[model samples]
Every structure is written in C-alpha cells, then in structure tokens.
Target chain A: MTAIAGKQPNYKVAPPKSGMTIKQQALINSIIVNAIVILLVLLWTIPTFGLLVSSFRPRDLITSSGWWTAFVTAFQSGAWTLDNYRSVLFADAMGSAFLNSMLVTIPSTVIPITIAAFAAYAIAWLEFPGRKAFFLVLVGLMVVPLQMSLQPLFSLYQATGLNGTFLGIWLAHTGFGLPLATYLLFGYISSLPVDLIEAARVDGATPMLTFTRLVLPLSTPAIAAFAIFQFLWVWNDLLVALVFLGTRADVAVLTTRLSELVASRGQAWHVLTAGAFVTMIMPLVVFFSLQRFFVRGLMAGSVKG
Target chain B: MRSVQLNGGPVMALFEKTWFRVLVSLVMIMALSYGFMVSTEFMKNQDAPRAMLAIVAILVGVLGIWALYLTVDNLVSTFPIRIRDFVRPFVFIAPAAIILGVFIIYPTIRTTWLSFFISRRGTGVVPGSFGLQNYVSLFTDPATFRALINNALWLVFVPSFSVSIGLIIAILVDRIRWEKFAKSLIFLPMAISFVGAGVIWRFIYFRATFGAQIGLLNAIVELFGGSPQGWLRIEPWNNFFLIVIMVWLQTGYAMVILSSAVKGVPGELLEAARIDGAGEVRIFFQVIIPFIMGTIVTVTTTITILVLKVFDIVFVMTSGNFNTNVIANVMYQQMFVQGNFGRGSAAAVILFIAVIPVMVHNVRSLKSRRF
Candidate 1:
C-alpha cells in the first residue's frame, strides 16, 4: 500500500542533444504524427460525412446524385429538409419514443454510477464483511450475457408485472451497466492514497462524508470518465431496450426507433440514416465533454508493481 | 454490540442483529421484485398497453425502497451508530440490483422457459414440443448452419484482427510525439454509435453506381481503374468485409487500453532486453508482451463477448440476410419478424451460452488486474 516509489525505468530512446533546439524538433515530430492522424480521421469521417449530407438531400437526390454534388448543385439543386428529423423525432410514436429514450438513458446511467461509485469505494477502502465475495459477484456478473438474463427477467417481470415499461428498461440498463462501472471505478478508487481516508476517519468523518468530501472529489476524473462510458453504452444499447421496453411506440428508445425504422423488410434507408444520427448525437456530446478525462496516467503507479 | 469498535471489522457478525444485513437485503429484494411488478403497465393500455402494471411495479420498486430506511433505523438503535455508515453502499447499489433482477435475471429465466414452448408460426416443424427441437434446428437447418458459420467466422476473425491491429497501432502510436491526439483520432470511430458506424460504412461499401458514386471505397476503386465492387454482397468475402467495420471501430479502444499497459511496461525491462541485443520486434515479443498478457487477455475476452452479441451492424447492414446473420440479429428476426418467441429464445440462449466462457474469463482478469 506504500506509494509506488519506483521511478520509470530508463530507456535508450535518445532525447535530442542538450543544445539541439528540442522545441523545433518536437514540433516537427508532432506535426508528422498529427498529419498522419488527420489523414486517418478523414478516412474515418468522410463516409459518415457523406451519409449525414445525403440524409439531408431530397430522397431522389439520395438515390441518384452523389452527396458531393451538393456544392456543384448549390445554385439549382436546392433540396434539404428537416423532414427526416421531423419524422424520426415526431413520427406517430417517435416524439414520445424520444422522451422514452431519455427516461431510460438518464436513470440507467445514473443508477449504475451511483451504486458503482459506492461499491467501488467499499471495495477500494472499506474493510467489510463479504468484500471479496461481493467484489467477485460484481466481476462475475459482468460477463453474464443480458440476453441470457432476458427470458428469466421477462418472466420475473411478467410475474411482477413490469415486462414492458420505462422503468423496466431503466433497471435493465442499470443492471447491465453496473458491473463495468463498478470495475472501472473500483480500479480507480482503490489506487487512491489510503492515508487521506484514514486520516479523515481519524478526524471522525463519516463514510458518506468521506466519500463526498474525499473519495468522490478525488475520483472526479474517474467518475466523469465512467459517466461518459456508461452514457454512451446505455445510449447506443438496443437489445436490452428492445427486450425490456418491448416494441411499444411510446416506450421505444432511439435505438429501438432505428431498429423499427426498417420496414417489415429491410430498406427504410431514408429514416434509418436520420435515426442513426439521432442516436449518435447524444453520445457524441457526452464523449466530447468527458473526452479530456480519459487521458492516461490518471492513476499512474498508484500501485507499485 | 457495545464492544464493537467504531470502525467496522471485516468479519463482523452478520447475523448478530435481528434485522441487519438480512433486513436491508430483503428490502432490496422486494424493491426489485416490485420494479418487475410495475413496469409491465407501459406495455398494456391500447394507448398505453402496459402502463398501470409498469407504474405499480416501479412504484413498488422505487418508492417502497424506503423499507431500507427502517433497516437503517434498526442498525442505529442496536448499535447507536449511524447505519447510513453501513447502508449507504448498499443503498447506492440497490437500484442496480433492482434493475438487474427485474430486467435481466427475470427475463432470462422467462426466455429459457419460452425456449421450451412452441413457436406461434408453426411453420418450421410442429412448432415447439417442449423439447430441444429449436436447438436441434439450429444445427440442422442450412440457414441456421450458415448463420452459425457466419457468427463463427466473426468470432474467429474480429477479435484476432482487432487485437492485432490495436496492438500494432498502439505500439506505433506509443512511439509518436502526439500520442494522445493520434489515439483520440483513432478512437473517434468508437464514439460513433454502432448504428451510425453501420450507416457510415454502408456508404463506403455502396454499390452499383450508374451516375454518381459517393461511396469512398468504391470511389477509390474507380479511381484505380477497377469496377466498383458490391462490398457487402461479395458472398463469402462479404462477411469478413462486414467484420472490418467492427475492427475499425474497436481497434482504437483496444489500442488505448493496451497502450496504457504497454506504457506500464517498465522502461528498464525493454532497455534490459535491448542491452542483450534484442531488436524492437524481439523486445516487443519478449519482455513487453509477457508484462501485458493479463490486460491483453481481458481485452480479447471482452471483445469476444462483444462479438458474441453483435446484432447491430448485421441488422443495419444486411438484416442478417446474404450471409451476415448472427445469433442476436437472427433471434430478433424470429421473435419480432416471425413472431415466434420460441425460436428466438433458443437463439438468444445459444448466444448467452456462447458468451459465458469469455465473460467469465473477462471478469476474473478484471478483478485481479495488477495495475
């Protein structure tokens, strides 16, 4: 538990000479890496970019003209509409469905994080009865495919009468989200200095106070990082939402909307594209906002090897 | 109870109090039981087909959670200490337990039962015989056979390539000056929702352009003087191509994790190896790999689990037809499309079993992580 006093091992990757103007060399190196990476990003983005542009084009243009021609046809081919967004968000049951997605995602993300943070704290610091077993259960539960649990859960829900509801989907998501959340947070919280918590407890701080005042605050980088993770996961998730929420239009989430956007046969291309974008947006927001916390060394050598 | 210290001992008498951990555990059990009870109402009214039942269940689950407060009071009385000290973690975890019990555990048991029931379609065989007919059909039907092969192909290839590419990229990027930015750009694909990635790649793999081709792969193919290919319709080859999207999306995630582990590899170890005349490749294979083997396994198994449950890309791309059907997508087809709950449950059960081993392995390594 002592601070991992070990320094980073030395290596032969030579630093530039003492007077070699390292700033210019570092700049050159970074630019080379950035250029290559920017190229990769373009390769990754262009196709999706094309799809997003195409989704806005008129249906005929979507089927015919390349999305690139939007620039050339700027003078004459004026066809872009909110119709797809309108249909995706406000379609017969979709407005309510969007609301339903919010309900499911919010509670799902919140519940797991709350519990995982606490359990993670306990696992990390609190010496308690059944700690190892409880930790093991969380770890073991991580791998149980939700699909396997679906039937058992459905019948249980049916018996209890919750087979299809916003709450059902929320709980399902929270359940699935917990294991990873606990593992991640526990991994972070455990690495924190023990003396800080011990010292506070010596000063008569309650566990809740300690968590709020010390553990939680110190764990902000981890909590934010995990929130982004859980939010993205629950947002993009379809299976649990589909199973627990059923196909009820009022309760269908964005993923369910994307799923249902397909006609009885496949080919609902127009709406599917819009629906995909809708689901992508929230996660993108969460990702960009919390993206900074995912920086490495959050817990560098908190534990010695 | 008076003799107990203020700080809790690891093995404190769990059953010493009349209603200690058991009481809180019971309250948790009922709250979850109630959540399952209430949520079905949302599915029921003609306008709200299942609303009342869902409401009652959730209310019972959520509001009734106050029972734990009673247990908290019990602990405070018996011990004269704030039971919130003991109960708070359990409280934080209660919601997750309730959700899991209702939505996952309950339904899983239900699906297992449904797998024994007969299909409503009554097309394939005499529906269900409460036997293993659905499962037998999985190995028997040519379509099912192809689906299994396709899934197997995915299982075999996706993780192998994703890990390899991820490792390669991680190693390459680790050596770069702008490590974080480069990794972020590579990880960008991961942030695109899986459904969006499908749509994204669909455009790249778009086929048969009479007038204008916007699809990048095909555009490049044309640029190289080759005819545009039907990327998703390339029969046996199509499956691998479809899996490439998963690799592209996941590689960055694997890279981020692996790169951290790689960074954790003592710089001295690699130097020590080089001192012994080991080349970069040799050092990578020797010292670097052994050090990160645990993380590598965890990442690989986690990806294995993901690949096992893959339905989104397949559903988005081909709707599991034209040689891309996985168990999850195919199950969705049976349950929703065919309205045959029995067959779908079987497919889901199969998917569940397929994931269990990798899932188990993943969890074990996760708990035992050295870093």
Candidate 2:
C-alpha cells in the first residue's frame, strides 16, 4: 500500500505556465463548468418542481397548461386552490392511508433497527464463533430481491394467519430490511473505538450492560442514520406491503393506495399531484432535517469497508 | 458449586448460581416466544381490540428480555469463562437470526422450490405438477423474452449513464462554491418514492391529442415546431424514457457517493499532473479517475442492482405495457395480478441469479478494501 514515489512515470513538460496566459483559460473553464453544473441542477430538479407547482394550481388550469405556464396564467387568473388537497385528503381517503403508512412504517423501522443494533454490537465487539460467517450471510442476503420473497412469504403469512395485518407488513419489512441495517450498523459499530468496549469489560460490565449503557448511547449517530434510512425505506416501500398486507382499505399503506389511485384514476393529475406530495412530505422532512446522516449512509452503502 | 456465605437470604444465593441465570434466560426466552406467537394469532384474526392488546403484550415481551438481561450480571459471574463467552453472542444475535431465517432465508428456499411447481390459480403451486415447466416457459415465451431484453437494456444503459453523469457532476461541482447546495438539489429525488417519482416524471413525459402540449418534453419539442409524441407509449424508446426516471432518481446517489470519493483524491497528485503538462482531460483520465476507480465500480454495481430490480417506474408509469416490462414487474404481475405463483417465482429466481455475480463482486471489493 505504500506510495511508490520514485517509480512513477513522468510526462514531458510542454511549457512553463505564464501566469497571465492561463488566466483566460481558467476563465473559460469556470464558465463551462458553471454552465454545465447549472444545467444539470435544473435538469435534476425541474420535474419535481413541475409536479409541485401543478399540485398547487387549479385542477382545470393544470390540465390546460404546462406547470411553467401556471406562473403567468394561474397568478393572473387567481386560479390556485386547495381543492386537490381537500379531495385527496378526504374524498380519496388518503388521510387514512397516511395513518396506515405511519402505523406500518414506525414498527417496521424500529424493529429491524433494534434487532440489527444488537446483532451489530455482538458481531462488532463480542468474541464469537461463526461471526464472519454471520456477517457474510447478511451481506449475501442484501441482494435477495423482495420480489423473490413474495409468494412464499404470503403463504407463510397465510399459515400463520398474518396475511392482512399491520404486524404482518411490519415483520415482512423487518426481514427485508435486516441485511442492510446490520451491515451499516456493523460498519459504524466496528469502526468505533474498541477501547470503549474493552474498558467497559474491564469494569466487569456484562455484554448486555455494555451494549445498552455504552454502545447504544455512543452509537446514536449510526442509529439515527439507520433509523431515518429504514423509516424512509419502509415508508416508500410498495412491493412488500402490497404482497403481505393486501389492498384492503383498512390495512393498505400510502404507496399501495397511491398506486391503486393511479391505476383507477390514471389521468387525474390534480389529485395525484396532491396525493404524491402528501406521501413525500414525511420522507422529505426527514431527509432535509438529517441530510448529513442520509448522505453518510449512502456513502457507507457504496464505499464499503 | 462454591456457595459463598452471604448476609442475603436463600433467594439471593440461588440467584447467584450460573444454572439459575441459565434457567432465567431460558424461561424469559420461552415466555417471549409464546407472547410473540400469541400476538401473531391476534394479528391474523383481525381482532381490533385484541390486536391493540397484542401490541402491549409484545412490548411487555421485549421489555421482559431487557429486564432479564438487567439481572444477568450476577448470574454470569458464577459461570466458567468458556461457558459464559460461548453463550453471550447468541443472546444478542438470536433475535435477528430468527427473523431473517423465518422471513428471508426460508422464503428464498421456498421460492426456489415453488419455481419448479405448476402454477395453480389462487391456491399456488399445484402438487404433482412439479417440474421445470415454468423455467421452460420463461425462456420460450415471447413476452418473457422481451422482458429479458428490456432488462438487459436497463442493465446496459442505467448504470453507465447514472455513473458517468454522477461522476461528471461530481467533478464539475467540486471546485464550486455551491457544492453542498448543488449536491442536495441533485440528491433530493432520492427522497421521493419511486411511485412519487413516477408521478413527477409523468408530467414531464405527458402527451395529449392536440393543443399546446402540456408536458415539458413535448412542450419543448412543440415549441421548436416538432410534433408532440406520446413518449411513454413509444415502444423500445419507452423503456429508455422510463430509464431516464431511474437515472434521474439515482444519479444523485451516485453523485453523493462519488463526490466524496473525488474529494478524497490527494491535492498533490493533481498538482503533479498539472506540472507534468497533462491537460484537464488527460489529468482526469489518468490521475483522478484511477484514484476513484474503486468508487466508480461500487457506484456502477450499486446502480446496476437497482436497475435490475426496477419495478415501480414501470409499474406506475405504464404497468409494463408498451413493451416496458422488466423482470421484477413481470414477476409482480404473475404473482399478484395473474395469480401464477410458479411463473412469478421463476421470474424472481432469474432475477436472483442475475444479481448474484454483482453481489459477489461487491463483497470481494469490500473485502479487499478492509485491509
């Protein structure tokens, strides 16, 4: 891993930098970079922004003009209304779906994080046999698509009578979520100062005590990161919920409900926009509030140990 | 057992024994398991009051495990070091293991088995009809073949574009003052649900029969005097349009990751390249890219896996019609819409097979990074 300084090949020099001579080149580079970056940012953002604007415009106005045109027309005509929100929230029963989403999401997020935290603590700190094997299995499990688990999982739910319950979706999410949860927490936990755990052990604290009192307290950042991640994941998930917790109105979460809304009312842009925003609000808030941890988690997911 | 004479009563002395601690843990585990099973039954019956009661019971069950552990210190003190160490990890690992085993591992094995069975509507997997018929049909069916080709198209296009676009953005935004703001804007879509993203992009790709095309893409095209096109329904090209949504959603992820990796490149090396008369392109290709090659590969593979499992966009945007069917979406249709569990399971297994090599590469690269 040592840097091989002398063995490096050197390219032939073209010329010495005439300080002022490069100024024009630097200016041109800056212009190109700024232009490209701005274009990219606009391209990345305009779709969502369009939808956001369309959500705020009147239903008739939305269908008649592009969202961009709403700036001129809707403002001139005073056509913006809260009717889409009213209809989506009340008439479309999205309010119930929103609550159902929360019920399914909170437990699903918490259960996996709790279980993964314990497993991560042990795998990271404890002296245990089959530890590497356990970790490798988790890493391997990360690639097992949720699609693969649907049919059998449904039957398992049927056998256990959990097919259409909130708890059923929660457990299904927990199972699907564990691999990444454990992997990320383990990465964060293993990198923690080993001496902290060792010092706890030296004081005769049991593993459980050290975990709760020491590791859990200190691992809050990683916990928060994984918590946000799992929350957003379970919140955004459509497949798992759709499979285990059928489309029963009593149990259907926001996604299944929203997708069904799309299926049934495909061209209803006004309601769909409002509904989409409602579904996105919580995750967006979580993302903005905890942007740092979210970015860190993304980095950890890709740039692994 | 060496019983230390203590001022406490016989109850305290009994609690001090290793076997007593073992007995307590065993009883606590059994009780927790029983409560878990009972709560699940309540869940199945859809008994509302009982379901709420089950939550309380489960909470008490979890708390009991915590309460048991709070008292375990003295119990473990009596055990020999070998015995104590051997059992400790299990106490922490068992909950995760049981959940993963029952839900993930067991289901995976069952899915593979079910793939060999015949599709029976409603009930799933007709017995004695077991064979490779589903897999056989998976290869032969034209629609399935088209889905496979579409998946291959996704595999080729999505990752390459996402990684390259992400890398380009990462490099461009590096020296800018608004790096954080720019990155956040790009990463914002990652917060949007796939279903939500589908809705957002539907506006962009929206088309109509006549009059001042409302969708941005068509608006721009029409503004230039080109006719409005139904972008999503145009076959083959439709798949690419759907992929654009994926790329738009994912490029930010790749950017956030690769941006950090680019920041990690040594300043001295870039200076050295500049001094050696390497132009921006030369220096980028030789120095910067090589240094961040590992991250690029990681990002590519990560996005590749995402592209393979892409369902929501197809599911929401077109429901896999207009020749946009992907493996995962097709599998969903078979299992849920068509009620053909065997065929669906087979599609899922094919997906599983597709993801393995990428996962292995990821694991190997990660393993190498450890040292």
Candidate 3:
C-alpha cells in the first residue's frame, strides 16, 4: 500500500497508437500534469507572497504602487526598508502582544498534555468503571461548538474574576483542549504492545512508575504531536482570547491585537502587512520546521476515529 | 517517602488504612485547590511584578496538579488491591473529567437553559420570561435570518470546494518529482490564523478608488482599462469572496489528508484497472476514489465542522457587514456587542444543534473501530 508507483517515470499505461508513439503520449501527459500543478501552486501562494513582499516595501511604495512593482526595481536602494516591521513591533506594541501569546500558549499546551496523558493512560490500560462511556462522551464532545460554551464560560469567568487574566485564559485553553488531547493520546496508548505493559506489572512496577518511566518515553511522538497542535490552536485562537481575555492591551494576544489593528486602521496597509506577518511568523516557523510531526498529528487526530 | 516500604511498622500500617488513605487524598486535593486560589489571587494583584507573578502562577498551577495526582495515586495503592484497581483509574481520570465537566459540559447545559428565556441586557434573565420567545425571535429576526442563510451557504460551499480542490491537487502532485515542496506551498496557509488570512486576502480584494491600485485584482482590472471595484460591498457575492478565503486556508488540510489516502490506494489495484482497458480518469473514478471513500468522508466532515463555526474571517474582514453575517459572528454580536444574552444563547444553541449529527457520527465510528 505504501508503494507509490505513479511517481516513477516508467509507470505510465500504454496508450493506443494514433499519430504518435506511446512514449510521446506519456511525455505530453507528464508535461500537462506538471503545468497544472505549478499553476495551482502559484494560485495558492500568491496572496501570502503579496503580503510578504508588501511587508518589506517602504510605506509610501506599499501605498502608492503594487507589490509587483517592487520586483521590477528589486535591486534599487529605495525599494525595500525595515521601517514597517520596526513601527509594528515597537510603535504598535505587537512586541508585548507577541510575548503575551507565548505566555498564554506555553502553559496552555503543557497543562493539557499533562492532564490528558494521565487520563489517556487510565482510559487505555486501567480497569475502570464507565471507561467505554467516558471515551464515547469525549469523542462526542470533540465536535461541540465552542460558541455553545462561550456565554456561560464568560459568565463564570466574570464571577470568578478569570476574565482578562493570564491564569483564566490558561485554564480555559486547557479545558477546551483536553478532549482532543486525551482522545489522540488514548489512540496511541491503547495500541501499545499489551505484553509490554503486563511485563512491567508482573515485575512489580507501580502504575505511576510504569507511566512515567515506560509509557511517557514510548509515547513521546504522540505527546509531541499534540503539543504542536495545541500550541498552534491556542496561539492562533481569537474567540477564546476575545471572550476570556478581552481586548485589554496588557493581556491581548497576537490575534486579538491584529484584529483590533484591522478594525481601527483598515487603510494602513504598511502597518497591517507587517503586523499580519508578525502574527504568522511563529506558526510558519513551527510549520516549516516540524511539518512532518504536524502532518502526522493532523492525520491521526482527524482522519482516524 | 521513597525509603519507606510496604513492610514498615505500625506507623506505616496506619497510613495503609482505607479511611486514613481516603482522608489523605481529600486533604491533598483541597490543598492543591487552595494553592491554586492563592496563586491566582497573587496574579490578580496589580502591584506585583507581572512577569514574575505569571511565572509563579504557572509553576504553582502545574506543579500543584501534578502533586495532587501523585498523592492520590500513592493513596490509592494503599487500598485493598481490588479496590485499588478501580479507584486508581478514577484518580488518573479525575482532573480531566472535572475540567471538562466545568468548562465544556456545564456551559453547554447552561447555554441551552439560557436560550429558553429572555434577557434584553446580559445581566440576568427577567422574571416570568420563561418561553420560546428567544428562539422564535431568532428565526424571525432579519439580521439573524441573513446570518443563517450565509451559514448555510458556507456549509454547502466550503467543504465541497476544499475537498474537491484538495483531492485534485493530491492526485496531480503525487505524479510529480517536487510533490513535497508543492504540497508544502499549498499547505502553508493552514499555519496562518483566520484573522491573518483575512488580512492577506484584504490586500487581494482591496479596492483603490484614486491610486495605481495596490491590490492585485484591482491592478489587473486597471491594466485592462477597467475601474477598481469595492469587491466587499457587492451583496451576496461578497459572502462568496469570504468563503473563498476559508477554502484557501482549508484546502491544504484536505489536500494533505487526501494525498496520504491516495498514496495508500494499492498500486496493484490501479494496474489491474489499466489492464481492463480503463483510462486514467475512469480508473480514478472507479478504483482510486472508492478505495479512499472513508477518508473522503472524514475530511469532508472535519472541514464541515470548521465551516459551521467560522467567525474570525467574517469578524476581521467585514465584521459581518455587507450581508456576510454567519451564525458564529451573529452570536458574538448579540451576546457581546448588543449584550442580549437570550438571543445569543439561542444562536449558539443553533450551532450546537447543527453539529449534533457530526458528533453522533464520530462517536459511532470510534465505537466501531474499538469494539
């Protein structure tokens, strides 16, 4: 099943001879496929590429001309500048918002993985009452609209003074992230060799020791995958941050801050372009660096039950 | 504590007693909760060094939970062996269950309850205001009606477009040498937030009235001697434009999954189809697609759920202006902007109801796989 013969040059089906040989037909087919794929790739990338180019162009140039114009004058001294990024980072206070995103994202990722790993181990291995029912309910909860929980959670936060605090957002992210984390981890933990777990038990390893020493190490790939998913989700989240953290400058993360910039300065493309890239830069780095693990996590988390 | 053994003296025997162990567990839980409260209180203090306080709070919250779990697990071990087996699972599961119950399960119930009442202001429901008035008005209101229609359009277009485009790209890219690089470029947008994507597309859809036309679309139009257009102000079609952005961001996700599934289809099966005189298109329809139908359903439903709750795109690009209101954005408007709790909760409940079928399907599939 893993063999992908279609990628090979020699894997073409023989076409009935008409005006040309079968080799020529295969060549034509390959060229057509490559052209179409390249065109689609360009279509998918140009929007992001436009903004990226615009971010580096000077403010006057960005407003007065198309980003494509900068490429015509690519080596000219006046074509590019760091002024937009400078103004965005320091003048617009995205620097603090960037830090705030980190503060909110890290603990949110760690706490959920920690909590859900324990729960997944229990659900997978332990002889618990209602284990099947609990697992089923968690699966059902995976698709529950976050909108359903917004108002009441906001009310609860207001009552408890969790609204607009770092602690509140952290706990809120953990709670919302738990169902998927536990479910994904459970899939991995349950599929571990059963005899390995039984071996530890027979050798007098306690559940806690077994989990820490054996399960945790063996499950690093699953744990790392969920960490990236949760990290990206929390970092890029807007609704949760808006509802729980509000648009308060001190607590605003990158999404809330960037959205606020869009609202208040819709015409300021210079700042908006740089500001948008600022928010995107981290996720892009994580994506390019950890694309393999991210894709594995996405498939395991979504495609499988 | 590590030095102590099961063979220790009477003092250890007291620790092993079921009643004493239960007391210790309860005390450990309360202590953890107390520590959390105190640290959060410290966080609430404005005079404290903000970063330091945040760090301390994180340490306390994380460490405190871990400490509670360890203490409880240890206590469970001292119980009779049969009881320990059962109690230990609950001990492992308690934190997750409590948080889910409090954060997700309870709020869902409360939101449903709130939908049954009326609240002009978000303070609380009015006395004697128990009825279906909120839902009735929800279905009747003009603005919300537009939102419902837009949501329906999103539900139809986003998933179908994303899945089809992704599937085509998956199949085409697989036959090429630079498959990984091309896939990464297409999939790059998935790393971007919806708000950031909105900003990126705003540059494309940006309309310049009196300039060289910085937006690419406007630039192309002007290059052909046509005037720039305010693309977002056009009614109904503007909704389609916004939906396009979602498709752009989500197509990569669908592509990645569908690509893997396409690769998983057996090479022998394709060869067999070719031997039977089936063309490539015919083979794709007959052999390849049917082989990955399960994955297609999975990708479609996943994208469908995302489309159902789409908010950031509309919220950022137009704030639901120009007839682009979706259910989630309208729910935000009623609840937060208008401070009308009842209407908002009713809107939220509509989203919840829309997702129920997907949820049930997911649970059923999971059960079938496991049991």
The estimated TM-scores of all candidates read 0.75, 0.90, 0.94
Q: What is model 2's DockQ versus the real complex?
A: 0.49
C-alpha positional error of residue A304 in candidate 3 after TM-score superposition, expressed in Å: 13
Q: In model 3, what are the clashing residue pairs, if there are any?
A: none
TM-score of 2: 0.90
List each candidate's DockQ score. 0.31, 0.49, 0.63
The residue-by-residue lDDT of candidate 3 on A145-167, one tens digit each, is 88888899888888887777888
At residue A303, give the lDDT of candidate 1: 13
Q: Provide backbone clash counts, one per model.
A: 41, 0, 0
CA deviation > 4 Å runs, candidate 1: A1-39, A56-60, A69-97, A117-131, A159-161, A188-220, A264-272, A294-305, B1-132, B175-178, B208-210, B222-229, B265-291, B335-343, B359-371
Best model per TM-score:
3
**Residue range B1-371, candidate 1, lDDT tens digits:** 34455545654655465566557566666765565444434433335534453444445444444344334434443443455456555644555456556545566677787787675643533433779877888779888788988999888998888888788777777766677777776777777767678767776787744765657678778888998888888898889888989988878778888888998988667656765667678888988888999988877776777788888888777877787778878787877677677888899888877766665665576568643
Worst-scoring 10-residue span by lDDT in model 3 chain A: A1-10
Best-to-worst TM-score order: 3, 2, 1
Which DockQ-derived CAPRI band holds candidate 2? medium
Candidate 3's C-alpha runs over 4 A off are A1-18, A302-305, B1-33, B46-48, B368-371
TM-score of chain B of each: 0.75, 0.85, 0.91
Scored against the true structure, residue B244 in model 1 reaches a CA lDDT of 89
